[model samples]
Target chain A: MAVRADDIPVPRGRPRLAGRVREWLDQESILGPVFVTPALLLLVLLVAYPFLMALYFAMSNAFIGRPSEFIGIRNFVRLWDSDAFRQTFQNAFVFTGIAVAFKLVFGICLALLLNEQLWFKRFIRGAVLLPWVIPTALSTLGWWWMFNSLYSVVNWTGIAVGFMDPPGPNWLGQKYYAMTAVVTVNVWRGLPFFAITILAGLVAIPRELYEAAEADGAGPVARFWLITLPLLKPVLAIVVLFSTIFTFSDFNIVYVLTRGGPINSTHLFATLSRVVGIDTGRIGEGAAISLYLFPLLVFVVWAQLRFVRKQAY
Target chain B: MEPIRRRRFLTTAAGGLAGILATRVPPARGQQREVSYLCWNNFAPASDKKLAEIGQRFTRDTGIKLKIDHVSHMGPQQAKYASEVQTQAGHDLVEMRMHFPWLYEPQLVDVSDVVGELEKKYGKAISSAYEGAHVNGVWRAVPQYHGMFVATYREDLFKKASLKVPDTWEDLYTVGKELKKMGNPVGIPISQNYDSISTAGPVLWSFGGMEVDKDGKTVRINSPATAQTIEWYKKMFRDCMEPEVLSWSDASNNESIQQGKAGWIHNPVSAYIVAKQRKLVTADGINHHRSLGGPQGRHETDTPRHIGIWKFSKNVEPAKEWIRYLLGKREVYDEYIMSGDAFNLPVYDKLQDHPVLRTDPKYAALRGEGVQYHTYGWPAPPSDKVQLITNTYLLPNMLAKAVTGTSTKDAIAWAEIEMRKILAG
Candidate 1:
């Protein structure tokens, strides 16, 4: 089977010329490069250049419709001085930490539970992704309307049931809980992707291995611990890394929810970067806030490389 | 794995294909002096009808065309302007106001002569509309309408609650407190913007607290008077508004009031039109008048909705001609006045006694009411600082902190620190 798969043709490595035409063989390798050129160019143009430019922007006193000045590290220093920036950074961490943690644990548990001989299994699996399927902006808008105190479902339930007569609390307005409200919306949107990814990994696992573990007098938990989790580690690492990178760079959820309001309760890196850079026209400061995500991406990339290598250890 | 990969490929292709099909194909250009107007939905149905007639007339007289691209809000409109200016995009006429001119500085041209003619035709009261449209003695825009920084309340509820429209700073606070206890959203805003900040500031000013003074120089928010004002506003938020207020936009705030959810709100004359469009209130409930007197005196700022012909226009000649038709003639001004009272003033001084404004022969009353020193006093901040001051250091946020038990001193101090920082930059 291995030889047959190999014999099908590993075309990427094929030399195209004989001894008289070695240079032509080098030119024939052009087909390999040609096929992926557009993607390579796009990845650099769209992703890499913009990332580098953002770092450059962070070091300058840049603003729109105005002349830029080279104010190296001042914007970063200013961010440290600002209470708003400090609060925004803290909120971003808290939101990403809580939401990602919930998505991981619950995602794995749900995936394992659903990987069974259940009726309507496909339908249930598809239906679980309803939250993820909806356009994020539209869904976040729905969440915003639902949190409305005058006609909000949350407020309605709180006020009518005598949860507290005078004030059921201004969930969005109160600084202590505004962050929690934003995190809840973020977590709800994220859970489905994590569940689906882990479920795919679970289904790909060999049943014989699990049965062999069962023959060793292992319970379901033991088998999961010994077999399923060990096999699922690579995908789980990828899933957590993807969720962390994306969540750390989250702008839309917090922007739509609070616009960093109720006294800077929910300002995150992405939204604050926009407010400082675009809306406030402090492009330098905005770029500084945005560049914080780079270190995070670096960690993810390192983990990704490590995850791809298979080892007995 | 093969089936899944094929499915993914097909799914991505389908999404992209659908997007291409859904876009609107642009119409082919014809030879004509065409101009594009970029602004918000200042002219709703009434405003739209007047504009269509005026546009057709302009096409007839000068053989030029008018392309209308009115948007729904000011924030996005300003953003679009910045983008258009940067790329030198295709807007010929743009409606901008207040501090927006400073952001562009000398990028726009002056039309002081045309503005002067309209001011003469509409009367001296009209000159007040140009208060913030001119930059350093050069005019860049002409006033289309006036939107004063005022609060709107359910007049019927006010009478029912025995609230005689609160005469002083104390009256507003006491009455607002009373109204809250009896189940009324004194005010709630679900979104943030300059409109919210501008209206909310007057409430603070009534207690002898001004965020930025008449000259647009000092940030006097750290004063004892300012602290007291903020503390009182904090009380208003805690005692009165819905929590959803902080979450609402200007339109949503209007929705709250129109839906009978909120009793009072600091808003513009546009609210009357908004209510009319939503059919929230009948004809009888659309009351127009001045805001309450401050502890010092009854006063407010001149909030005019203005329009401009961009200096960077693809066809500046046609745009300038269009601006003239929109506001040049007396009859055109009348059409604007009738269009949901767009201009916010009556055509004839004698005829200002409509049920929409003053009752009886109180023609001179509006002049005295509107022409107060403080109302025309404060110098408008530039557009860039306007965004920072309004969005970052708004009264609603101040009220939120105070209500949430953020120390009054700390909130005020921090706000001052931030406001001064932006101003200095």
Candidate 2:
């Protein structure tokens, strides 16, 4: 016989279960987590898992294809004593510090110039981005050709302009010169990001504030110092932080240009990691070398975030 | 009723997940024969074309499929091999170069059967071939070919300087100095490049210096002979070579000679071949000769190539068959050499007199140079430790440190320390 829904003896937990599920489905908080579950899972698998694996590998005596043993901090300790690793660590700091500083200065100058009412402004902005827009490996190859000792166009230009004596400078042959050449290329490639980003920040600044600063009898320099600089601090901090990270772990420019050469003068953390980890098949040491900069990068990023948060508050 | 529905839903979802995972799992193979080979980019495109043609022919003959992957021969290729060995996955067959057979010996399959069969047909292989492919009394790989380093120089420059072609290291230095005075410097890469390692090998050996002993257990880089080699390089860097040699890549020496700025280079015949092919410089403008003799003896560096099947490969038999087929037939091997423009030298004694070498005047000297060819860590059996040192470029870096102003004693001392650390590890 057919039975009514209420006529059937209600299961002991049926009503409670229905109520709980309905409440969970109806609540926005529950829905929020449910909707984000896929993304969270992806984040764990893609980003967090590899990062954790790298951490594990760094602590183990792992060679590619060979079984690994837990070696504690031996990899880190060895890298600490390694002359090559020490030099690479030092190179990372110097290369990033100089590259970021120049990128900022040039970026701001170019942004200011581009902001002015001028002919071909759009064209100039787009053209300025070619170095950034091109694939880094391909662009660096072009730079390599230009830095060639015998067939370098830069040397050719210098010779024709009489700015250099015969034979010209070997742009990538000496320690100091190679460092300078890599830094210059880094700056050249990174400038567009800063320019476009800072330009956006510049455009976002309300015109009324600048007008008021000028009305208060401020000169161009005074208005810039009082209004433009303060207004651009947050954006500048962000751009600089990104550029710093990119420069610190940079592999393509150094690898393509010198392969950290002329005697390991230009090796960065990434190239050194490859040399140790992949090339030498010392995955453990390579992993340790790569992660050595993690703590410093965390500090830099955290400080920038805190500064941004303080400004926001 | 509600609990039952929820349980049903959970079960359905779990089953769906299981189904997805099952689909992702590779299906079991019955008897389909297929293998993939990974190798470095050939010096000439025609060489790759020849290889592909042979692969297709193999497929036709045996009903087995062959796939070949060619990658750049430098850093990336090394990384690929390391990755494959570490992961225990990738390519059924791989081209092993230099010290790789020894470096990854545990992961490679024994190819004694292939090598033995081929040797029975083609006489004895060269000693250098055995030096690279045979490790621990096991044939780890099949010796493929040798890329010999010979001197490529400008005949025009030598004529203008009224100097004969250098037959010894001293003569090279003397000629190099004269060329430099004329603003045409000899370009021997003093930097950390593959060519630098090859160029340094002969010099170090010629001076009777070695990085390791014949047992591959002792560090011998701190000898007086090594110190003398360092001093000689310092003088060469100061007087004969351009400062730019410190930063030269593997391609720089080729470019320097092609552009008419370099008077001499120690490279494979690729430079000369390219110059003639491109007409960047005419054939008459360029000339090639055997490596210069050092005080100890006349020797050259050999970057031998080998073929090995991975232990983890599913189609090991097919991989072995492919290697045997490629290396066994003299006609096919000679064709490969011809296609490569004589860039690849035969490892078998019988094929040494192949028409490819005998026909070309430029390749004549190289034909017999293999007898005098030596690999790095020479006299010493190549080991993983030795491979690590080679890859890290410790030897070249030592010379660079010395030539760039670090004292010879200090440079050798540093190298000894580095070598010890590598060996100990």
Tens-digit lDDT track of model 1 for B1-425: 35568888899978876765686432234346688887667544676777777788878888897878876565467567766765667587777655465566555767777767765765543434545676677777766665454556677777777876765556667778777777776774523445456555565565567666655767777787777776666766677765656655556666666777666766665665666656665323534345666664556655566677667776776777777787676677666656645435542233334343432221223343533322222434455655566646455666566655779987788777776776665
Q: Model 1, A203-261: lDDT tens per residue?
A: 89999998888888999889988898889988888889889888988887877776777
- Give the TM-score between model 1's chain B and the true chain B: 0.80
Q: List the residue pairs that clash in candidate 1.
A: B99-B383, B188-B245, B189-B245, B189-B248, B190-B247, B190-B248, B191-B248, B191-B249
lDDT of 1 at B269: 55
Clashing pairs in 2: A64-B86, A65-B86
State each model's CA lDDT, in order.
Answer: 0.68, 0.86
**Positional deviation of residue B335's Cα in model 2 after best superposition, in angstroms:** 2.3
The positional error of residue B401 in candidate 1, measured at the CA in angstroms, is 1.7
lDDT of 2 by residue, B1-425 (tens): 34568888899978877976788643355346899999999876778999999999989988889999999986888899887886778999999787678767788899998889888887777778888889899999999988888888888878977988988888888888899999888899988788999889889989889999998889999998899899889989999997888888898898888878888999998888778778884456888877788778877888889998889998888898898778877777777777878788788877777777765777776765533887877878887678777877888999999988899999999999988887876
The most accurate candidate by TM-score is 2
Q: Which portion of correct inter-chain contacts appears in model 2?
A: 0.61
